[model samples]
Target: MSAVASETKTRQLPYVVAITEGVREVLKEQANAFVAGEDVAGAGSVYGYYRGLLDEFGADRIYDTPISEKGIIGLGVGAAAAGLRPVLDIMFMDFIGECMDEIANQMAKMRFMFGGSATLPITVLTMAGAGANLAAQHSQSLEAWLAHLPGLKVVMPATPYDAKGLIIAAARDDNPVFVVLNKMSLAMMGDVPEGPYEVPIGKANVVRTGKNYTIVTLGRMLGQALDAAKQLAELGIDAEVIDARSVQPFDTEAVIKSVEKTHRAMVVHEAVRFGGFGAEIAAQIQEHAFDYLDAPVARVGAPFSPVPFSPALEKVYVPNAERIVVVAREQLGI
Candidate 1:
């Protein structure tokens, strides 16, 4: 077998391994591709996703920045605008608030504001959601805030397959992309193709099909939803699971179609219930599939409170398989 075929035949790796592979592929493919963020270079990212990148790419390409979110993003935006592809690492998704102006106003709007004269090919890779007992600040899922922005592309890949492919696609795109990785998913092991792959932005993947109800989810919440679907099946309620991989350019058509078929919908996420991505999904479902609905749209998410530091409280605060099953049954009138 050829070298390519040999690599392709290798067994599947974990989500964090796929991420590392994706970054290595991008740096190998693009001369201008570089990485910058806190503890990214020498320390190899907070989660060690960039472990060997510094050694392979050298200090210039794999740079270490100060503990300043604004500075890190601003530098990435500047580099992207100047014709280089820069991938930035914000230690946690919650810190996005510190660089909201840089992201929302600057990087997101630069291309459109410049009348298409400039392309900001920047990717902001950050970890989100509450499962690690990291407390409120480090565990919040704020993809809703980024998705609300018009000019930015928001991507949340649930599986190792999509994670590797989507990260490469985001890096290669000429527009700004926010690639949010769930901290809990980093060590997840799954099958991933070895060659460079690209999962298109704004596309939704139907993970499982059923005719009874539709469960729309993203990020780590997807696993919970799938598990819940199995339990719902035993209870005589068939549930379809749709992974809303990209939120900004959301796949409303898929969601509408799924809801129309099932006539019952439940949106799930790791974010808070109020102002979460579930709200958007619920609103969209009501708007498009209202006539076909057999029951009201239900939402499964974290409570409207800060993530607790204790593992016991943290487990209760975050939605899990049990919560998903309960919400699905409630929506299905089971």
Candidate 2:
């Protein structure tokens, strides 16, 4: 027998970079996979995540539609119903309200109404949260609203690796998938493997392990929660960090397990405290892990007010690492 050699490759990049690479790969792999939205083709999306896609895929594949959110969503729904995997961008997640009827009534319910005969593989990518001081409308985290709906998948990627993998998975899934990418995570750098990869929707990732308390977070909050865990460590609190990557599917098993070990939990998010996604996580933890819990589940989120435009006020509006640390201490009775 002769010895054989195996090759290995490695690369590090940001979430936006990984997303760009995934979009390119999807465009290359599937002829049916098309991109559409305002400024998506020529402008490469508002955040420049889709930069050069128009040039590479051509105008036919990467299209720039008119500034009509409802029209863009309707087109995506129709195209998906007719057998095209269309990736539509609505720029900001808050703007999804503009096309609620199209997304909720048509795209989400079509398959079930048709007796499961149709497969609407539509992926809508949008930005959310309040960190860049983009004002009220642009900074809302409305994932909780979408997660409440049926026949739809909601994903929030916390890292560059998850961003690429989840997008690919969303493209391949039969249901309509809404990917809420955080603006802050766009430029965040991390390790990402090459080639096509898919992170199955409805799964949660435990980013950090500990035993004192569990902090369940999603999207941009995951970073802050991890940082908070680091600070808590110095204070003799080993906080576990769970990234609820998929809001709709929501990994209750992982969450319950974490709560079982820690016996304490603190749910955090950038969304408002009232009726936000954190509420649902808290409720679920209470339902399943109530017996294991030593204290009531705590939630840390923004106030019930619009995101401010002033940079100074915006800093106070969004949840940060220090806030998480403070909340964790209270929940742990430290």
Candidate 3:
């Protein structure tokens, strides 16, 4: 089901504010839910999304932990296993390396290893993407790492609406859910409904409907894909755009269906091209709709290198609509 609401009572909220509101509503609804992470309680997080949450939820519910990703994630795993819903914040997604053991082995496999007896209802909120010039260590899109895990659900919400809805949905889930948010989109604004709402995980949204060609996008790349669609339309190519909101339980059906109609498809993402999630999407499209494909499935992503610190290089390093349009044209022979 599409997560977007068509109600006329919606109001514009920045991507960061929507996230804060989502967490607020989750804490309000789930009595057992609590949020803990570095600088989240005292400084309201590095991105300022958690601003004012500590005062609203109190210290017990909103905790300030030491600068340790392993300890923070470990706390969530233990807390969730003990019946409390914990929202753990990993300040930068690149730091997932420091706590790989906790995530890959413990938090992700506790349920199955225990024969389904233990439940790790852990919701990890981490910042991703590379437009803020946070350098290599601080900026990265590592959703593929979590998505590859067996017992984890990975979600990348592009807009303010999905950011809010997905957060609430992740909090209420019974398994580990990673909400990979884009740091560059924090100031982006969109319509969001008041109160709590859930955007179902593992669902894809057809943001733009077209014929001729299909453009499947992940996370922040949705906007670029849409822009490329418009530019392609001007050049007599109607491109259908599908947002792969969830990466692990990817919405293969939506993409395959679009490819069947369009006969050509391309996957786009902010992560590096090699060994990126877009490769997985491209493979799925070919495997499911190979007979109907007019051309090989194409992929557009950042180069396989660390996110540059130089603003000039970083601007070129990130994938944009022009790149997508060029790739689509080359693949489509238009």
The numbered model that scores best in lDDT is: 3
- List CA RMSD, all candidates: 2.5, 3.3, 1.4
Q: Give lDDT per model, in order.
A: 0.89, 0.89, 0.92
Candidate 2: deviation at residue 210, Å? 0.5
TM-score of 3: 0.97
Q: Candidate 2 residues 1-334, lDDT tens each?
A: 0111234233789999988977887888889999999899888988898999888888899989998999999999999888899999999998988999998888888999999998999999989978887899999999988998899999998888888888888898888999999988888998777777788899898889998789999788999999999999999989899999999989999999999999989999999989998888999999998899899988999999999999999998999999988877776767
- lDDT computed for candidate 1: 0.89
Ranking, lDDT, top scorer first: 3, 1, 2
Q: TM-scores, in order shown? A: 0.96, 0.96, 0.97
**Candidate 3 lDDT score relative to the true structure:** 0.92
Q: Which stretches of candidate 3 lie over 4 Å from their true place?
A: 1-8
Clashing pairs in 2: none
Question: Per-residue lDDT for 143-174 in model 1, tens only?
Answer: 99999998899999898888888899899988
lDDT at 213 for candidate 3?
87
